[model samples]
Target: MKNYWSRWMFVPALIFLFSSCGPSAHIEKDKSVDFSRYKTFAWVDKDGEGRKDRNNRNDITESNIRTAVNKQLQKAGFEETKRRPDILLSYDLLVERSTVQNNDPVYSQPFTRAFYSPYYRRYFFVNYPSQFIGYDRSERSIKEGTVTISMIDARSGKTVWQGWATDEVSSRNLTSKEIDAVVRSIFKKADLAKR
Candidate 1:
């Protein structure tokens, strides 16, 4: 009986200690968002440029991007405003694009990869994660991008909901599949009560 109790206590104690060793994060919503107040949807381009130029409405021709976001909201049970949407819709596009060299050594050969192995191979024996770190020898580059999002109240003309996503833009510009995946993930993260 004593041994059983000790074993049980040992397991839970290790679990508590291991769990507590990590970070502490919590966010409780007093209540969910009420979509009732919003009705109309109109795209906004506060700083209209290539990101979202009202003058060149044709420049931002990815209606599917908007559609994908709308679908996510609808799936979450928010009704879209048909006529005069309660919410004034606007696309606030803030695209941060950069060429990021993926130092991920997966592309490098076994010995050639950026093996950030301790320079003192004899005494300092430590396995570092430099295999993928571009280090000095091998390098890979890709376009990394971030899109900041925003929402405005149609009536009051005030900003309401806002969110953004950072993603990899391939050589093919912004593929529909890429946009859809990233946008959907953004909505899910900004909303889901993670299970």
Candidate 2:
């Protein structure tokens, strides 16, 4: 009985450990498409006109994303080519404003007070019990960023695979390391081992 209870308790703990890792990536792909035929890739937005972040940091963030994605794809035997490639790749980054609400419990402090009683004709001390009061509510604004990557067939112009990740961001642009992690998470969820 002891062993069975211990084993049962461990299952929930294991599930919680994995669930709290971090934000998860979402992926979509065409099941009927043959992924193995895709060997070379090129950027769909070659001129950067469709990018969201076209400010001073636009070039830096674009470089970070491209470097990370290229590294991952090359490791999987996919090459980047400027000629007529098998697939066209495109990525986008978007940051949006959000609000978070927090509520904390409010409590009353216990205390003792002295009072005069007419029946007892003496001073008496009474203790007051602590109790729940109410809740303190607050709201704060935050910025969240989402990165999306898409792979389309060059000849047919149909998207074959797509992945995206969303998380709280510190700035409008992501650093190189942050971009790498985002790209890595997206590719990790992709089932392109055979290709």
Candidate 3:
């Protein structure tokens, strides 16, 4: 019985810990555009230059993001082409620090305490009244990172699909696998391959 009760109590804590760490993504796409028609894609220059530009301030981070996006797109049956492709894929990264505040309601509970009357020299119980305690507010600053991937129609130069994945930045930079997972999650939610 004790073991079962302990297990039940631990489940919620475990769930909360895991839920707080997972990455989330939001995807938006033009419903009118048929994604199935897009069979090939090419990377768009960050500065809209004729030639491929490596002007991204963080070369390593950009490389990792590009590699991960390429892998996910290829997995979805999109081929990278140099010639005029069906869609132009572009990605951007943003990192910023923000303060998050949590306001927890504080409540006071009624309680009974044993007291001794000095004159009577006897022990007596007194009821402590319950009252509303204000709120316990705490602020924490966190570094947040966002990766936005957009697909533009090569001919029209209009965005057809976009995905944004944001999460707390754990380190100075994210590893290749981490980037891959984030991109994959975004793509998975988009369901790009489905007709």
Task: Score every model by TM-score.
Answer: 0.51, 0.68, 0.70
Cα deviation in Å at residue 194, candidate 3?
A: 1.1
Per-residue lDDT of model 1, residues 70-139, tens digit only: 7776676555655666665554333444554444334343432243446655443344343453444445
Query: Per-residue lDDT of 122-156 in model 3, one digit per residue for the tens?
Result: 99999999888999999999877778999999999
Q: Over the stretch 3-82, how does candidate 2's per-residue lDDT look in tens digits?
A: 98987998999999965665578999999998999999998766645457343357678788888888888888899999
Worst 10 residues of 3 by lDDT: 48-57
**Of 1 and 3, which scores higher on lDDT?**
3
Ranking by lDDT: 2, 3, 1
Q: What do the candidate models score in CA lDDT, each in turn?
A: 0.54, 0.84, 0.82
What TM-score should be assigned to candidate 1?
A: 0.51
Off by over 4 Å in 1: 1-36, 44-61, 93-97, 101-139, 192-195
Off by over 4 Å in 3: 1-21, 47-56, 107-134
Candidate 3 residue-wise lDDT at 112 = 99
TM-score: which candidate is best?
3
Which candidate leads the pack in lDDT? 2
lDDT of 2 at 30: 94
